[model samples]
Target: MTKQEFLRRYKDENLTIGAEYMMILDKISDAPLVLGCAYDQGVWKIYKTGERDGHYIIKEYASENEAFDFFYELVLSKHNRRNN
Candidate 1:
């Protein structure tokens, strides 16, 4: 997605992009947002941060787009439930 669109969609959060990685940080907690990207065993992967530690990962994904979509949907679902 375009940087402009990403910024518009996730305006509530903080985001930083690097040469090999994109880091999405939570605005309130300062925690890494969405998941993170990694290349493992000759393949690209994405992972979500675990609750225990910064290095801890809760889940992994094989496709970057699927990972991003899932994270966005999760956030939207949480928000909708909160508003209800």
Candidate 2:
């Protein structure tokens, strides 16, 4: 999706434009699976590359430390994504 589309889609979700982020991932099938995060509007957004393209937000949080812990679990192959 184009930048405009991304913004339009997630705009109502409270994700601020140009938010700061950090990506930490493990390789799968020779490709770097993006198990990463971005902080916006005082919330931590966790994303991972998967069957769908784009930065798919798996979860959001108010605590940065909690977000990091979530990432740690994800990297260790412990966390599971649940869609609502």
- Estimated TM-score for each candidate: 0.41, 0.48
Q: Each candidate: RMSD to true structure?
A: 8.3, 15.0
Q: Which residue pairs come into collision in candidate 1?
A: 24-33
1-84 per-residue lDDT for model 1 (tens digits): 322444467665533232333354331122444444444554334455444445444445665455455555655555566556
Q: Pick the candidate with the highest TM-score.
A: 2
Cα error of candidate 1 at position 57, Å: 2.8
What's model 2's TM-score?
0.48
What TM-score does structure 1 among the candidates reach? 0.41
Please give, for residues 1-84, the per-residue lDDT of candidate 2 as tens digits: 322343354445433222122234222121234556667667877776643455567888787667666655553343222311
